[model samples]
Target: MTIRTTHVGSLPRSQEVVDFIFARERGEDYDADGFDAAMARAVAETVRKQVEAGVDIVSDGETSKISYATYVKDRYTGFGGDSPRNAPADLKLFPSFLKRIADSGGTPQYARPMCIGEVRSKGQGELEKDISNLKTAMAEHGRQRGFMNAASPGVISLFLQNDYYRTREAYLAALADAMKAEYETIVASGLDLQLDCPDLALSRHMLFSELSDAEFVKIAASHVEALNHALSGIPAEKVRIHICWGNYEGPHVCDIPMAQMFDTLMSAKARYVLFETSNPRHGHEWTVFRDRKADIPDDKILVPGVVDTTTNFVEHPELIAQRLSRFAGIVGSDRVIAGSDCGFGTFAGFGAVDPDIAYAKLKAMAEGAAMLS
Candidate 1:
């Protein structure tokens, strides 16, 4: 079988979408319906571009979102006001590096929303809008398979500061309950539902490294529990969970090893797992699959990233094939798919690879999968 291609969501926003997000962030009010129309157009264009890139499974490019995890604030109640967004512990460790990021204008200065009360769906018709937009694009472009991103219960916990819930675990449970219908709605469409869970691995160094191994495991386990509960009745096979450390080009010395987090990764009900591979920090960690092949259940599939997202270089098709082929050798061709290490545009208005370069990279991934097959 040919290695299949997919991507982490949040593809690069167009100049229009980028400007809208910035203006909205700056308290500039524009015509509401006009904004929606522009976003829909962007989603349509991005889907068409992905088809051209030869992606087997595509997304709506998360064009309507401000950021992947933080977009929840707009769709859910209880998140209001502002709070200090803590820099990742790793980033904080080097004050000099933080200065460099600020000086370089590499990172955007956006407000971090805080949860100020009990949780509830915003009832704003947001999720419906997203699904409708993606489905419409797929129909127009004659594509069949696609996925829409949802913030995992864990990732929501990771980025949003909680001020109302009495306990952290309670906050997570509320978030899970609030988001359960979203999972159901997406899966009900019968397209794949991608639960983006960066907290499992990224949080280890970002916020949880101060935790002992036992403490980290406890928190990680809670996250998995919330996710499984939310995914109840949704077939695990239709779900793919994506994990990655920070998408920034920062030192990842504090990243948790794949082996250390394998158990937690397995705990989610999702049957297909997508995670980083080609980026420099965790690129060499593929041996974890070779060593613990049995840890992967027979029914599960691994979409190990074969291309890097945070760089400008376009990977050779043969290189992507070699990476996918390595995973196939350890598991089997049927169990492997190819993807990027992380999203090229993890956050709106922030991207490492140029947008054109990002598509070129996916084109390489598709060509490589052909070579491997």
Candidate 2:
């Protein structure tokens, strides 16, 4: 398998459609078919562009969802009443310098569950239908080698703020069972599945601050267990788990060190570990691999970010090649896949760089891979 990787988080959207969905929440005038068609076109176009640029693996540009993780809350069966809310002031992960620069703009929120709703998980049938749509769109546009991204249960449970459950364990179990259905869908689709697990690291900043480090590790382990349970029959080769710090143009000083969470992460039943390794804050942290590699099983692959997503400047191909070479040297080229530090558009309404610039970055990455080869 090739080691190149790429991303197109959220494509440029017409202002009218954005307003209709966000401002009106799919009001009466909104046409679902038209919306789906537009999204499919955008996804196909983006994947086509990446494939042409030599991205070995591709995504549908995450075009259908408003926000990556928040989209699941709408599809999920549980949660009643309380809407998503902003992260508390103290828990805000961005540093003071960034806050001042961002003008203290309100960050995205998670939907709080006031009441436990029935497990409205996506079964095999729903999975087939959606996967069919994406695959068909790809085929129609002559695109190939694409994957789907699913939000991790930890992310869903944490961001949604399930305060209704009597115990944290019970809340996690409920979310685990519900999310398993979605996992099943991804497995059955026959396409590659990437679990979006930014929560594994970012949760330390957004969800739990009161707990000791030891306690936090325990909580993180449960998330891994749930994923392993859902992935029981699936071959690890078909699945990959992606972990990152918050994807924004902010100071990530509060981000958890990868070493602190490597144990729980390696325990996940996935063949590939997609992790943040680019960006100024996390770049040198690759040394964590020297100490933590013992915990990582040999069968697993490492897809380290070779380019930083929060910046608009294009990385020199030589720099991208060097990053890939370093990871390959540490873990072997066969086990390494070059990736981005985070998604280009983590938040729907906000973006640090233009979508076209994001593509140029991927193109640079592809060129670098060729140079290294």
Candidate 3:
């Protein structure tokens, strides 16, 4: 098989591009139909770029969704007015976030349990239509394969609105049901589905911030069960689950090692697992593979990050090759596919690393795969 590469979820061409297009259309004060038409064109353009760049699996660029969590929140309905629309005080550096959102004309809304029937708004129910439209558009305008991104219920539920549910178990089960509609939508659309599940390992910080290590693990295990339950009927091979420690450019001191959560993650039903393995903070932990490969079933594929996403410096092809070789040495080359540590522009509003540099990194990734060949 030809060596393949894919992103975990959001790319640099994420909501930033959406917001940009939205601004341009609103500037003209275009009506709803005109606005959607402009947005659809923008999405197709971004997808074309990813496909042209040699990405084997292309995404809609997730231009429609804000963040993985926020997007899921928008589609469902349940909770109302639980708390003020403010960033957590502890996240001081993000103080201007709320103001920024307001400046962008975003409204503060209450979050809910994300259950079915409570709110029957079909956001992505048109997902198949969107994919079909993109396929036809791409075939006419460009050429490529496509995939859709869905949030894992475990990850979605773990990032909660305060006191939403009496018990975590109840919240998780509800999230699973609501998210199944999304999973089924993508599968039925006849496109490959990649589940964005950074919370599988990263939930410790977001969900269990107040708990002790032992307590957190106990809570996280239930989340694992919820994830497996949500994905119970999906064929593993058509699915790829992504797990990361969060995709921010920050001090990841609190990020837990996969060693601590590997068993829980592998238990989730996914034919392939996408994980962070590049970047100085995580690169050395490739040793985790040496220690844990025995537990990873042979039928499962491991798509390790060979390109670092936290910096602007382009990784040399040889370095990318070395990363691939390292993973191949342990996991078998046939089972390993190169990828990036995380999406380049996870936050649409903030511009840190230059977009041009992000493209350079993908170029390096493709070259690295070629070197391995």
lDDT of 1 by residue, 1-373 (tens): 7878888877999999888877877789887788889889998999999999999898988888888888888778888777665677778888899889989997766767788988898674878888889999999998899999899989988888788999888988899999999899898886789999988878887677779867887888889999999998899999999988888877887787888888888878988899888988898888998888888888889999888887898999998998898899988988888888878777888888999999999999999999976
Which candidate order results from sorting by TM-score in descending order?
1, 2, 3
Number of the top lDDT candidate: 1
Name the better of 2 and 3 by TM-score. Answer: 2
Better of 1 and 2 by TM-score: 1
In model 2, which runs have C-alpha deviations exceeding 4 angstroms?
Answer: 8-20, 23-28, 83-106, 109-115, 122-130, 140-144
Measured against the true structure, the TM-scores of the candidates, in listed sequence, are 0.97, 0.89, 0.84
Tens digits of per-residue lDDT for model 2 on 21-78?
4643433467666655665555556667767776767776565556667666567666
In candidate 3 the C-alpha lDDT for residue 188 amounts to 70
- What lDDT does each candidate get? 0.86, 0.70, 0.67
lDDT per residue (tens digit) for residues 36-143 in model 3: 565477567766666666666667666555556655555676644433232332233454764564586544232333332342335664465457655755675565
What is the C-alpha local distance difference test score of candidate 1?
Answer: 0.86
User: What's the lDDT for residue 194 in model 2?
Assistant: 79
- Which 10 successive residues of model 2 have the least lDDT summed? 8-17
